[model samples]
Target: MALPIVAMTLSSCGRAPELRVNDAVVILSPVDSNPAALYFTIHGGPEKVYLNSVLSRSVIRSEVHESKVDPKTGMVTMEPTRKIEIPAKGTVEFKRGGKHVMLWGVNRPARQLKELEAEFIFSNGDRIIVDAEVRAATAGDADKKDAHSGH
Candidate 1:
């Protein structure tokens, strides 16, 4: 009896939950050779999921990264991250000095359009397309200590 009930419950929620991506922005590097940063928010739905990756044809390279504080050096370090786990009914923010995406070589079209349509892929094989505002990097963004200038 319990086995049957469990099977029914699982079957009832077979589909992926309603995940949403918002507040996406891609700031182009002022130097043109440096990679740009992408920040966004992922709102979880009824079930947990993993953010597999972010893709965009507008950029030459795209990757997910995170910032961590090194205990020994007492400094901040940025590294590449394969995936990010989003809790059920929770939210994950990709911002500066934290988990964020890096886009390299903003193409002419993307720069001209001033936006990048980024595809957020999930573990459940769902893809959410979002228009991320693109802006020119400022002098403050070139600060290497913050690691936003290049990485």
Candidate 2:
């Protein structure tokens, strides 16, 4: 019985990490000249996962970023990030005024697209493809407000 239990535990430990993305959206630039922001909720599997980067043919470049507010100055800023860690059996949210994927130099066709397909690359050599809804900056105001409030 003890040997069987040990074998089961070892097999489970070797399982690959699973990732699921939900509520994915892309906020297009108002003038189609600036970078777009991508938001989503990512759920990790049994093991912790590191999100290394995002890839899309629609944009010239893409990177992960984190937003922060200066409590004293009341100023908001965004900083580039290399990786985002998703806790095991937990979720990470990328929303407005928080951690998000930045897409730069979006092509004209992509900007006009209703939805875009993107690939999320993990540090452990796993890639997941997802379709993200496109939204204009003027749209999703209610969602943005909630995101800013950290809800």
For all predicted structures, in order, the TM-scores are 0.83, 0.77
lDDT of 1 at 114: 89
lDDT per residue, candidate 2, 1-151, as tens digits?
Answer: 7999999988888656567888989887665566778899999987888999999988899989888888997777778889999899889999888899988876767657778888998877889899898887776564454223221
Error of 1 at 5 (Å): 28
Residue 122's C-alpha lDDT in candidate 1?
A: 94
Which regions of candidate 2 fall more than 4 Å away from where they truly are? 1-17, 139-151
TM-score of 2: 0.77
The predictions' CA RMSDs to the true structure, in order, are: 6.2, 5.3
Best by TM-score: 1
Q: With candidate 1 superimposed using the best TM-score fit, by how many Å does residue 2's alpha carbon deviate from the native?
A: 33
- The whole-model lDDT of each prediction reads 0.87, 0.81
- Over the full model, what C-alpha lDDT does candidate 2 score relative to the true structure? 0.81
